[model samples]
Target: MVRRVGESVEARLDAERERIALWLPVALGAGIAAWFALPTRTHWIGLLLVLGAGALAGLLIGWQRRFGRAVVVGCAVMALGLLLVWGRALWVSAPVLALPVVTEFSASVESVEPLPAKDQVRLIVRPLKRPDLPPRLRITAAGEQGKGIAPGEAIGLRARLMPPPTASLPGGYDFAQRAWFDRIGAVGTVLGDIGRAPGAGDGVQTLRARLSDHIHGQIDGSAGGIAAALVAGDRGAISEADEEAMRRSGLAHLLSISGLHVTAVVTFAMLIAMSLLALSRRLALAGYVLPLAAAVAALAGGGYTLLAGAEVPTLRSFIAALLVLIAFLLGREALTLRLVAAGALIVLIWRPESLAGPSFQLSFAAITAIVALHESRAMQRFMARREEPWVFRLGRGVAGLVITGLAVEVALAPIALFHFHKAGLYGALANVVAIPLTTFVIMPAEALALLFDSVGLGAPFWWVAEQALNGLIWLAHSVAEAPGAVATLPVFPPWGFGLAIFGGIWLLLWRTRWRWAGAVPLVLGMAVLLAQPRPDVLITGDGKHIAAAQPDGSYALLRERAGDYVRDAVAEAAGIDAPLAALTDLDHVACNRDFCRWTQDGRTILAARGRDRIEGADMAAACAAADVVISERWLPRECAGRWLTIDRDTLPQTGGLALYLGERPRAVTALGAGDEHMWRRPPQVSGNDEAVPTTSLAR
Candidate 1:
């Protein structure tokens, strides 16, 4: 009996050994993602320990190869992944201004995009002489000041430049980190920008801008906007209302140029090229027909990538499409997990920071799930069954679409809740109608429009594309208007998301019955979603705006009609569904011209506007009555005792603050909770004389 048990264990271990190579890249990717998700940036000492330990273990395993070779290899690969991500982080961690600076400067516009607002444009600029600064800056211009500015046109302007804003709350979206990877050092508004400078040069951005302009000119209104979005990836032309409707209906992905669009364009190009070649007997009989078709498809995908601005998502899709095309040319199955792994590995090697983004996570998750479903035994058996009647085939197609939509939605639900705190409940129903229209009619027409526009014959194709888009838009609006179409949830904690991702990868990658173990972490992640805590008090990054949680589970703004963005962030963090416009009911708030006061947990909190109003008797009274005093200006020394005081000096380092009121109240700040990395400015060491009396509750 003991010998039989030993034989069974050894057999299971050998079977697992055969699958280790397939799991290596996924494990490596998880390691890289884990590194980026750290609360504080890793130092060289920790990295050295990881690498050295992994190497030592690998060497020992090689010496005793009968037992743990797979484990050793996984450790080595994970360590290597961590090393690569750390190296990428260091490479991209260039510094921006620590404080906001108002300066006059000249830069060449690399690209110009219209904002959602009327008469506003955002210019991506390259600095001419400032090597110390970031490679690019995003500048906002109003009125006609930047109307006709094309890419590669030098413009001189006065602007107030600052580092991209940090996360509004701890573990919230880190715009600063994103800007760092994007090579944008600063973001500013152009005060006055009509002057043309001397130096400018043409680039890919120039070509894309020209193409976008031509597309916009050829089409008009919402139809034109959708056409431009499809052809040039200029989504800014679409109205916010339309965008919102699409999001609510779960059709927003159609607006972005991604895997589906790239696949459609490449497939259409290959089909068209093959058809034309087949028409000519000489070309059809040629030995290189397959290679020629592959090349055409590759070129088509590459051209579309260039038109779409080659952003991270587009680049990833292009790489994946190219890999699939290569596999097809090599007479191998195209949509295998190996191909996806190769594509993912290549993208991570090129830009490890992308692993931290929602687009990268959600896109890859959906793709992996769909591909896994296709390769499942049940799906394969269903596909291999005897031919069915026409009606049965049609029903099967509908069922396939619904299944694909469900798989993708289920795979991406955790990611959506983590990033955006919402999910579209009617996405599958909307996609049932929307995907066919987009894949068959809209995308094909847009491809034809692109081809025709090069020869100044695009009007008819644009019209056809517009008609398809009109149907899609109507469907989106109708679906979004339905009750319970969108479901909002609270943001999941980082660890919960991490666990969910691991479980998802386990389920998708494993090929054995043991894969069901993934359900454990998946369930735990769902529990975490229900267990997440809400903040009692929230403050804006600028320290000028504040919101406090009320007894009824809604947030009340200290000042009305100000800091809508901050209010929204706070509300989302707290899982509150209150509208920004409806947060003006100040019945619970006591306010005068200079100060406003609110109470929570039997503690009075004071928000003062000016230093003059916080002096002498009023100051003493505020300190005596309030548990926390927040002010825009510096406060006096006598007002610091049992209570906490936050003012201008402390606010700069904090960014934003969240206070938890209990028996022993605590607080956390955005900066205090964030990773101390090279991209961020270190917190200042205040002198004793200037130090404020406040306790940091950052964990």
Candidate 2:
């Protein structure tokens, strides 16, 4: 029996040997993710020890066969990943604004972005005279204050600045985290006239801005905006409604200047370069075809990546494209799985923090799944079109494109739910139309229009591009509005999401019959997610906005005056449409001048809207009787509720709170309990669980 088991184990190991390298990146990403999820950073000494031990073990085990060597290598890669992000976090750690400040200072503009709806321009500026402030400040200027401001200009202004905002609620997006990665410490609004300052800025930004403006000039309205977003990654002109529609239709990926756009640019550049060079008889005979074409493709992709601000998605896409071209130049068929893993490793090494973001997760997941699918024996055989009629070949191509789109959507669904609380189910159908239209018609026409515009004949092509964009927009909106187009879930446990990801990767990457075992965890994870109990009460981080569930299968907004952004976030988290009904007219709850009482299933919640209300209430009795008590003001020690109490003291500690009312009550926080991410706090705040004193948001 022992010998039989040993042989079985060896068989499994041998089967997976070929995939050992592909799993290295997965291990590395796991380490990086583990680091980010921790509430506190590991001690430097411990981190160093792990890194050293893993590396040494990896080297010593190289002579060992199969399983043992693979284990050591994976551990070594994971350690490397952990070390890379740990070092990065320490290196980039800097002070963030602790409080709001209003001051005057001169700054060198780092970048300029315009918002068309508000006629406002935004700038990332380095404050010359205010080193005490955050080094990078995002400032909004409107009207004459921002008129004609270019990227490299030095400007002066007085503005009121505040720390980058944290997540509005538990499980919502972390804006501050993103700002931290971008090195933006403060966000503000220009309060007065903008004046010329002492220095100039880089010209690369200026060039990008010019290109965006040129495209916007050619197309009109949101269609023009889509054109610009595709070509130069300028999404400023795209309206919120159109953007939302894009998200709902699953076509939002097209708008992001990621894999599709970069690949198209590289392919076009190579083919055009080769064809143009082939026209020259001498050059054709010289047989420099592939080399020169590959070079041009590289230049084009790299230039476009830089011009698109070289953001994570664009850079990642460009890296993958460059790898493929290099493989072509080396006369080897690039293995898709290896290419993806290599690209991921490079990007993670450079920007380890991106592993936590949706862009990185979604982009890589879609690619890995698609590659695995096509690499399958069944798909390879099904897609083979040799000796087939032209009509049959065309049909197969169309069917394959549609099938690929559906596969991508399936792969991306869980991730989208984890990040955005929603996923578009119809993106595959929409993409069958949208992707081909964008790839074959719109982009090509736009390029031709730009080329012809140089010689004063761009109008006809521009018109063709405009019409195609209009159709694309119409398709997105139409598909988005279709019944059951999107799948949504309320906030799910992150652990479940992690399990889902692991299971998915396992099923996709492994060739063994045991790959079917992945389905167990995949289903279990999604079940855990869908079965999570809904929060009865939702509170914003600032303690100014609140949401409560009503008995009639609906939610009520306590603070009726919250902005659209806040409302939308809360709504998404609750798995409902935004602009929730105000609590004022709700019939399910009883309200008095001092407090509101919501009761269901023999449990009660007492919430105060203002300090006056809290002062007037009988909190000791209320706290004892009620399942949960909530207020913005500090609650007395004696006023603890039966289950939970969230006030200024605890609210600030947690950032935001979600109360689940039931037989055994529980609470979830926006940053999770004891979260101490450096970007999430100010310089002097303690990272401990003890509450920090803070004032309630002023009425």
Candidate 3:
């Protein structure tokens, strides 16, 4: 009897596999994603040639009816996909400024958006001169200098330009990589007033800016900003406090133009089209209803994507929705894994670098999990029941929301912990109220407002949207304020994230009890996270600030206010849960105006900033007493000795440093020992002296 049951299960699994051909594209996308994640740069042309030759050989073998023809063909396709991704990455690589330089030139403004700060605006400019530079440069202008700049208008200004900052540590966020993909090679601050030249903004950008301004004029405060963000993807107007609240409450996704917004807009259009078709008996009876509704939904999604600036996330979502609509038009089930796989394939082909972004990861992860759940036997059984009463349907809808919220939260938890080292502990509870309110109230109202605004009759709709937005914001704030709402997690290594992703895919893509095997890798990933080591000391990217980890799991800041951003980043990466302000305790640190000293594991460290202080007698005494000295100023002749030291010249190339203290202390920088990326400066030659050389510091 046991053998018969096992045979029955095997037969069921075989049947299930025959029904789904989606895993092919998914595997292909995985190959492409893997290619993009490599730290080492590839010789794109050479690699593609090699891969192409292998694929051709595989295809020829498969054509001859080889023993494993299907496997050979699949492998060939995946290899080709990886080559395609590599080619795309190479095509998008732009030239960045090799060194910091100040230049004055006039350029056409592509867009003007306010920064989170009070008196700063970011200008996306197209440099008229220096054609060798990247097509676009993102410049941060102080005060009201950039406030008057209009899209497409030519403006002249002098600014210091530098390559985007590298990651603070290896495997941390790489702003330079993101900037490279964005076609922004340089970033800097405006040094003087902008002078207007002869030109107008680009037509599309002008329209978007006008629409954003009109929306803001109609609504008020954070509500207007939220409305603008939903309708036009203009998040510049949103208050930082509200943004923080949404993030803390796990409702930040709602504020962005993501899959949820795209789905909502499409559903709204479909319902409207269906209702109108019902009024026309001939159309409803002619069997054109489903196709017509799908067409309308596709149009709505496309329109929304364009309105939202066709960002990567919105574009991906629209592509997925379009695939589903096409399936519906063809009289097939629309919510299949094949639809998502195809969408992912399209996104990877268009912008392979997007695979590195959080939005891409989170959105696709949620969609994949949801589709898998829909295909599960449990959900199938639940949906198979006969039509129920209104109350039962309402209860089911609420339950469905809860289940979805929980599933997405769980699916994305590992990624969140790996990247940000924080999880919204109360995200499920918060979403129970937040998702419904945003989906049914806020988003719909904003859509209506946008529709009305285009026709100059949007006042009432904007007011309604504003009211709903207020409630949503309040809910986010309240939830964020709850006790233990946020959970700080230990840092998870890249391999841990890899294992978790693999386990999730294995469990979701397969049918049958064998899928339970995925639990092994999932548990192993959790173990890796728990076992990861924390850095004992961290230095800022600018080398102006440093922090030491205390025995009690707190950080001692070397400077009070200079490296606030780095302080927070290091604290999060080190799994320090205390508030930033409370991390530095004077009881454990000794400091004077010029220098601060801290000890960890019996090793003394000294940090100094000002030039005058570095030349003072106090600095000499501190350097003599400490085992490691980090000075913002150039290293003086007197301080050369066995004690390790980092000074101005080496800091720029290193970016940031992480120290591990033991019997033999060691150091690692943001640029790894062997990293050879474009943004990294060339290695510096060191002279033989008592001053510890860069290469010797890590030894």
Candidate 4:
């Protein structure tokens, strides 16, 4: 009997494998295309070569009926699809490709409409209108403009008008690549203006502006206005205190209408729609309840949850909602593993870049783990055969919530560390409280406030909602500040990130009794992090003072700046607060003071002319016998020593002379320099230094 049961389980696994194989091509193709389409400087020939090789490999494998032949064919198809998609994106299809090299520009908002979290202000600009340039042109303005600008008003901007860079953080994050899936390629910020903003203030934007004004007018006295903003996604009117409250409470996600908020709205709408349909029982309409509920869910949840914002998590949730709605409309099964996989595939296909984002990984990991736990036979039996009191039932619910938080925290911990460089040690506990409050209390209250507004009794409702959100904020801030709230993680190598991803997928999808197999990546990721190499040169620089520490030894600085922001950054990066003090006493100097110094065995040498600045001299002779020549000024023209400039003005085009002298003239010890020309030439000792016998400076 045990053998038979094992065989049945194996058969189910095979069936799932077969199902995944069938739909694999679409997912693979979309992913490949998106990868190739990313902004890169490589030529098309390389891509074409890859395409040909993949096609040949697929053909050969299929002809031989090799292992994983079906998978190979699917991969080949996906590669081709990606090549086509990205090729089109890089060439003719992209608007950025078609745009002229714009020089002068100006933007004026024709309208500004309020969205859930931000104001969508539309602006039109005359881009490079010179007859010598492209005459007919327009630029749309958007994003991080600081404050909301109104219609009929214009801001002057100067920029090299081109398509926005594809979203991908170089070493951090990418917003443009995600927007590519959403079909937005162009954006701009004001630089300078040729004239005033152009346009007449009128239409729907005006109405939205009026509504925003009216809401603020009504709720300005209390926290109600910001509450309305949170509900409506008009963050422009929110007070600093209210914003702080939500941020502190870890409930900031609520302020922005996201998956949690949408799920609640849809569930509530679904319940209402189902109840109304149930009341009409005798009409043979039992089958229609789900469909009606789904439609209402779409109406209430779709725009706000999905369409209202650019956040990738909302889009993922909306995709799941779509899957659920379609299933209901067809009277099929609900919320299964297959449905989750399907939703994931859809999101990956549409926004391939999102695969690397925290939202996509965290949201889906939490949901999938929760669903798996919820569907376990053990869990079902416990819930069904519970002969316990209400207290026990409540305890079980709390236990379930705790389990959910742990699952999500486990899944997201590596990613959070990888991205933020700091892991939230208490995030799980914070989430346990914050998630329930945001989902159950905050979202519903905000929605109710909207309803109250329609009934002309929103003021009281809005005030109550504000208090709830404020309480949540206070909770997050408190949690954030709790002892050991976050722990710093050593930087991990790139391969570790790949390993972590591999392990996460294994845990989530491996159809094996030995689920512990997924722990492999986790262990490897941690190992890689522990083994990372330190940088050669480290700088803790803000806009003011600059500090540098060599890998071999001590630290050096030009001077202490106005603020500690820079000094603190350096100290943190170097993992030493003690070394920064050596830099604090450095005398205050001019903005461009190119000081260079090195501290060794408690000895210090100033490379530059001490208070007396020199224009031309064999300064190298003075520091020839010293441990190191520290400079706070330019290299004397006649010094003729191997020196590397540490100063900013290294360009020859900017009226400064470029020099190169080195038998390996150590590096021209400037703050910075013009070019490699200075580093390449043999050291030439001119004037008095020519007769002085010199030794090669140690690297």
- Say which candidate scores most in lDDT: 2
Clashes of each: 0, 1, 4, 47
Q: lDDT (CA) for every model shown?
A: 0.74, 0.81, 0.73, 0.50
Superposition-based RMSD of candidate 4 using all C-alpha atoms, in angstroms: 12.0
| Highest-TM-score candidate | 2
Worst 10 residues of 3 by lDDT: 690-699
Tens digit of per-residue lDDT, candidate 3, span 1-699 = 955874565465456664346556655666666565544555434544565676676565445433224445555666766777667656766667666777666678887786533558898898764454456789999857776577767777778887677777544687887886676778888886777653433223456677787877888778788888887788877787898788878888887898888988899999999989878889988988878888899998999899888889989989988887888778789888778888887887788767778888888888889888878888777756568898998888778777877888889888777777777767877888877787898877777877787788877877788888898889889988898887666445577888888888778877767778888998888778767667787777777667777676766666567554676687676766575443245676776666667777888877774546445443566577788888777877666424578888778767677777878777767665544443443221111123322221111
Candidate 4 lDDT over 309-418, as tens digits, reads 43566667777887877886776777766787788777765655455566666666667766766666676666564678999889888877777677766666666556
lDDT of 3 at 169: 58
Provide the TM-score for each candidate, comma-separated.
Answer: 0.89, 0.93, 0.86, 0.68
True-vs-predicted CA distance for residue 401, candidate 4, Å: 0.9
What tens-digit string does per-residue lDDT give for candidate 1 at 1-699? 955864564565566564545676776776687676554654444754776686677576463542346556666777777778878767766556556776665677887887533567898888655544466888888857777677877667777787788887655688888887776778888775456643432223466667766767766666667777777788867776788789878888888889988988899989888877677777777756677888998998999899889888898999999999999988899998888888888888788778888888888988899999999988877666567898888888788889889989889878877887777888987899988898898877877888887898877988888888888889989988898877666544678887887888878877777778898998788778768666777777677777777777777666666655676577666666565433235676777667777777877888875435546555776666788888767777766425678887788788677877878887777775455665675222111222222111100
Q: List the pairs of residues colliding in candidate 2.
A: 170-670
Off by over 4 Å in 2: 1-7, 42-62, 198-205, 611-624, 636-638, 681-699
lDDT of 2 by residue, 536-618 (tens): 78888877777887766567887788888888888778776445888867776777776778785567878777656343255
Task: By TM-score, rank the candidates, best first.
Answer: 2, 1, 3, 4
Error of 4 at 276 (Å): 2.8
Off by over 4 Å in 4: 1-70, 77-85, 88-104, 108-170, 173-252, 281-286, 305-307, 310-312, 372-385, 530-582, 585-593, 599-699
Model 4 clash tally, residue pairs: 47
